[model samples]
Target: MQKAHTSFALALSLFLAVSCTNNKDAEQIAPSLSAEASQSSKDGILTSELSKPIGMSIDQKNQIWVSQSGTGKNDGSVVVVTPNGRVQTAFTGFGSQVLPNNELGGLGHVLYQDGMLYVLDGLNGRLYIIDVSSYKAKDAPVPASSLNFIAIKPFVLSQNLSNPLDSNLYDLTFGPDGRLYIADAGANAIISVNLATKALSVFARIPNATPTIQAVPTGIIYDGSKFLVSTLTGFPFVTGLAKVLQISTSGVVSDYRSGFTALTNLAPAKGDDLLVTEYARFVFSPPVVGWQPSTGRVANAAGTTVLGGLNEITDIERINPNFYYVLSTAEGTIQKLKY
Candidate 1:
């Protein structure tokens, strides 16, 4: 184990963006663990292979909060990491173990605004709100009551949806008008939840996707006027079909740009453009875990490479005008990069 603020350039594997398995017969991308294959940092960058880090956000105090979707039910947790790299537990032990098989909720993306922390429970199909105003930083679990979780339906594992994949909640963001938008890969729809009234409804769906394939939405970001979403079409995510769409506030959805393979996460970049990351590369074979060898790269709005040769870059967080923090899922560490 390494301490905070240590710099070591690593080229880690960036795994899949959305972490839900819908079809039992579907191929699972569960790659074998290897620090040798993973912890290959270089060029003097700070790295720490935190466990299952997915969603991230910088709070008002500049503290980094990462929601880690642990490998099992009842294992999901969140950690508050400083920009300098020191890590501490924000909360833990919140999900319940379901009956029959002990299936538990998996924590995915997290958003922080004002004094509230919003966490998307990807596995359990619920959302959680945590107020960190009085909580002190420590690497220990807090009271489960303090977690403030809302149980959505069982959206994963044993979800009994009309469409099996409809239960996959991949990403979430808060709009300027004070509403939370969610990206559901299983249903390929964007759902919104009103925090004040606890009202949930379908915001939009794939209005122009190929009916033969599943155009699942993975990542979503509110960019002033509209919400930009990244969609993954079909089981083995194809390049041409992995395009970003712009959804209006009234729920009108349309394509914005293309030329990505298994696009997973999206973020607002400098001046009217966006930063998108690919979960995997254009592999000709069926999707396997960690098959793309540093095939992932970060691109600008015009499909130009900003950071090339990445290993499954899952999420990108802009710290300032010219600096960003990229989450390399396969490497299990967050690396700093300048654009």
Candidate 2:
């Protein structure tokens, strides 16, 4: 029954990806993507080219690994691009096959650790761990393409919860405490799973807010003592209520910042500061458009800031002591922000 539902959801997403462009007008329907930095803060840098970048993580080599959930079929793939904007290698989705009129390779999120690249399959509730050292998908008993892959291996994590409904884990990162914190967007909760033991626990469940569907959770990070989670109000109007919540190790969640909408991914930098990627532009959805300047922290904020001009910020990472690099999925370009 769950597999059937997942198939339907994937089909719908693929449909949206195809007609995403203005079919009647035959024009790509991206955000207005204004190249103007006029309305942006001095901190906002403008650029395009990040290619629908959704998930990101820094490898041991410090290069940025990006996953492109393209706008349509033939657009999805995994890219290993250097900090200097050079494409190293590209891996196409499972096979070259694209479902008839369906989008392919919607590779959503990625994690690079312990010489392995773990990709969370958004189309299905499955995890694909690639051996970074081998550059090949790991040798799972189910051949790496089967939807029934989970039962084939003992690498599965165990959670105490009796109910196992699909939550569609999105952005994930290791907390300061070394536990894996996953944005269980389907359930709007930040899930903490012990990496060493795979014991799972619900760290926090997002409280209901305006435009109920926008309650979808996205990015997450930990800064020594607290965990920060990003929210994208998945509604049809301008609620402008997306926020980042600060959760303690004990699992107490609080609204650390509010008023902004559709912030997707996040990363931590120096001096108690964090970087966020915004994904507010949608045509079949919202009307807001254009390249707003790459907005992020110039200096560590005492609290989160509710501002604008950030394109679909999908990922971030601290390159050096006070310098951070941000990836804009909408623009396909990276910004180097100096704090």
Candidate 3:
């Protein structure tokens, strides 16, 4: 069963490689933005000292917290970046492993709510909780040894399912009921956790994109009423197949939108508008090594491109009506945009 789990992980790793190229080439892919949308756009804040940053969240203090999946050596960490770009490590020494395809997996996503920081360990199904209410931007790093974690894999394995050998606790969001809903990429399902009891349950099983392609759930968000999930469709990634799913608070899953390729994350925009990350379009043919450079994009619910030419964009955070931050894993930088 463990071997089966590793195989599933290796397949997902093929699509999670972070590019090391600069964003200068990415700007050329899509040179045009809407006149109103292009009012002011500039890469903001932290650019250096990032290692395969995957997940990001903003707190009440307006502090930006980012998770780095490290160089696949158990060096994964979560850092707090102040509004002025001062970076400080908050937690260190999480599990980081290099997959068979050379992709790194470790800290998956970070969520800050109230006074606690919820972190997901992708390589090993676990959730680490830290009290960051009193943590300042200049405070020293918090070692993982002092934090408490909840083992999620054992609970996932206990549930009888068709494909239950593996569990990759990826992106997560707080549901209306105050439970933590996690997108398990390996199991292809949403797992809900009761914070009060630390109990786990399979909330909903995501259907495959096609007859053979699994809808690997990547990022999730709660929009007051329902939960929205983004998927990175399985191997041999077909263009225009990836989509966002709508899951009810009661656990019913249905399609919300389609015609996307390699969707990664979603964020609420002005009014009912939604911003989604199109991670990247992969290149499988000869002479093309991996994903097409700068093909990644930030699009709306209607499939309209808002920002294009991004490289491996994994997360998007909206700060206010006109301000936003985008995390480009490949570029290892946070891009601030005003619309």
Candidate 4:
């Protein structure tokens, strides 16, 4: 186990981008861990082989968090791992235990706010508030079948808005002001929910004129002030536009960046830097999945940063001031980067 863990990390380290330097030489090549993998598992490293590492979030304690949805017959789950890759806890919800691999059960997206963890139920379209200290669902499931008639029933958040979300409620996060934000990729809208009163409102919606199959907003991140979002374009071949839409505390939305494809996730680096993963090749005949490292001053937003090529980037997080952690779903490896 130790050797396997080290090999995985070494493979993933090869792709981390060091700086915003457009020059190829400035890109940082991660040191191979194959030589040290013998010490990995013994050191408490955790690893996985799954379809996609769909979403992640960090708690006040700074523990790294992640969720994976299996393709079919795979039994999806949510995992909490230490900075060193040790498994903290893995959740396979009570009712979801019988869900098929690709049925979208288990955990889809996790959000940590105050001292609670909010998880979106992919199969049932329900939102569960989990006690961070306990890691258990606050209430039972709220089925879409009875959502309309119910009155803010069972953590539904709101009956005034759409209930039983259309499809996979992919990503979720809280804004700087404390209101809860969720990305409904299936419904094509970014929504904000009142945590205190269970009221729901659409924060941002993908325009129908986008000229893609359908827009699926997968990830949400707060850069201390605004909410940054990632949208997977609906059409194949056309690079899925991964854009950042800035939303103020007042619910104002503005275009931040586009032209990049498959912006699946985002994390803040030290200074004004961000680590963006580009799965540009996912829409092809055979999915060309890779991760890219890019850095730039915050003012530029997008389109001007120096972007490196893909390197199996599934999820990203700023583990510390200078180190960023990335997940490679296919490689089943986690990487640490210093930028």
Candidate 5:
């Protein structure tokens, strides 16, 4: 996902000419026994078969769903990985493209709720809905052409905004009011969708991280009372400039926390804290014009690092109180962190 910074910028420039874009449980064990169990259960690498995975979500049955922005050949897909590391392709053949920077662009973040999977396509600007209630681990892969989706670009372009021509529906979360709130990285705003009516509205426009750079809002989550959104600041991708914005249920946005770099996703932590993914720092030198490897990390809302040395980290999912699954697009692997 760090590669997206340059790729998306290139795409946005072209548009000026011609338009486009948890879990838990158990209480009987002693403190010592539980601590040992937690330590032993942290399987660092869940699976290494993913090809440029950009998003992830855990289901009711503890299955991890990942969206892969395939090798830019219209082969994008979503796969299901069991807790034991078993992987199965659930859907395939979505639109994908190889950006000018050689980065894969297409599939974005995914969400699973009540047996339904919400897949976001950043390249095409569409939200796909797939019914996976009966999709067992043994079920065969399904073709994306067979499913249904809602084209968000049309609705987003219809709204009056500073940048209405572009719409990249990057990440989404269901609010307390049951509306799907999406972080539009391209449009630099939060969009709300009425699931029942399929209506779209601009909830809030993200302010610029700096006077010259746009705030590319990426990951988002609703914490019962409000929405928390993360930003991957534009251009030079300056360090310690990205922030996590807090939005009221009614769409008022404000700075919740600052002093982070290239934030990609957010998750609820114990109490009022949050677990965020720092994708990576940008290297603008000619020899290394991309994300600096091993600079990504998992940090708390206070900007304290929980885990570091991550390469191109894209998303983070909290499975239980003691563990988190962190996705590294560069490594094409998920590392289970014991918190």
Candidate 6:
């Protein structure tokens, strides 16, 4: 890739020609979850007490990789949890380019495929590619270092600490078309990353009036066909305006659900319809909307309730054809949910 800096076509072709290796590790680690893990109200905490953790994805062995925010520049890190629930720090960043509070920037989300890991460094407007395989010539992954860290120009927004779009990057999911789909919340747009060339582009942008307050996207996924994006609105994040948008491969955007208040993530349920998580309900205060500790919940495709009383969930993963797991960023936990 370093050499390809002189040859764009060579880089893109080499990247596009390679199919993502389906390294079995992307699925469940166990043939079957244990009895204790299968309980109806299962609350098996995979990892807990994290420092402002946000995004996560599973690897070949069902080890959960999480993006954790640090207190200052260069403190953000990526951590992993084994199938048996042991946690390990995989790597960290040198720090973000801008920040006012600790939570706004850092390594925000992670996407794992085969032995490769893609991390979004929101503060610096860059993407870090890490080699997760045992034979990586540089040895195992380490903090503040990477196999590659490519700069994304679009994410280099106003470093003004007051900019509401500061959470420049949010969630990420791999598209069947061999690209990475990213939720650029601050810019009110969905971005696509060319894996081969490490190029960035605005795939789809919400046509709303205020990107600074209205159209922050958080969660995104590819359902083997089209894409679904979740958006957050207003600061302290109000309840009414947040929603999920249906995005086409050609960059068309439309509302999939408009009634959701403080929506965080989306995933297909074990049965029919889609499953969504709400960040919080509306209440009175200067921060008109805020997270209610242990109050997040999930709903079905038709906007009907399914599960309730969760703790500030940011992402969800369906591990099988029958069950799913949700991430609580606040609680730093992952709990299995049976739909």
- Indicate whether candidate 2 or candidate 5 has the larger lDDT: 5
Q: Give the per-residue lDDT digits (tens) of candidate 1, residues 1-339.
A: 110000000111123332331000001111232334234334524458478677787665556678776655577778887545667877776453332323333665787766677777665677888787665666466644466665554423233332433365667887666778878765567777788887677788764345555666777887778888886565445556678998998999888998776676777766787788876564555565434667778888888988888876667776556556677666667776667
lDDT value for candidate 3? 0.75
lDDT by residue for model 4 over 265-324, one digit each (tens)? 666655565556654343223332333233111112444433343345556655445545
Point out the worst 10-residue segment of candidate 3 by lDDT: 21-30
State each model's C-alpha RMSD to the native.
10.5, 10.3, 6.6, 11.4, 5.8, 10.3
Q: TM-score-based ranking, best first?
A: 3, 5, 1, 6, 2, 4
**Candidate 6 lDDT, tens digit per residue, 25-110?**
12222244545434423355655646556667766566667777665557878777665565677786645422332133455678
Model 2 spans > 4 angstroms off: 1-50, 70-76, 94-105, 134-166, 196-199, 211-214, 237-239, 281-310
* True-vs-predicted CA distance for residue 166, candidate 6, Å: 6.1
> Candidate 2 residues 1-339, lDDT tens each?
122113222322422344350000001111221233223313444234456666665555554567766554444556675434445444554322244545343555677765666565554444555666644223222223432222201212243221234455566766767666667655566676675665667777666455234356677766667777776655432345667788888888888876654566666654455556555433343342322234432212343443345544556655455445566654666665655
List ranges where model 4 is wrong by over 4 Å: 1-52, 60-62, 71-74, 94-106, 134-165, 283-312
- Tens-place lDDT per residue, model 5, 244-333, is 999998788899999998888877777777888988777768765666668889999999999998887878877775667888877789
lDDT measured at residue 167 in model 3 versus the true structure, 0 to 100: 74
What does candidate 3's lDDT look like per residue over 40-82, in tens digits?
A: 3334534555667888877766677899887777898998876
Model 4 residue 192 lDDT?
A: 72
Judged by lDDT relative to the true structure, which candidate is superior, 1 or 4? Answer: 1
Name the lDDT of candidate 2: 0.51
Q: lDDT for model 1, on a 0 to 1 scale?
A: 0.62
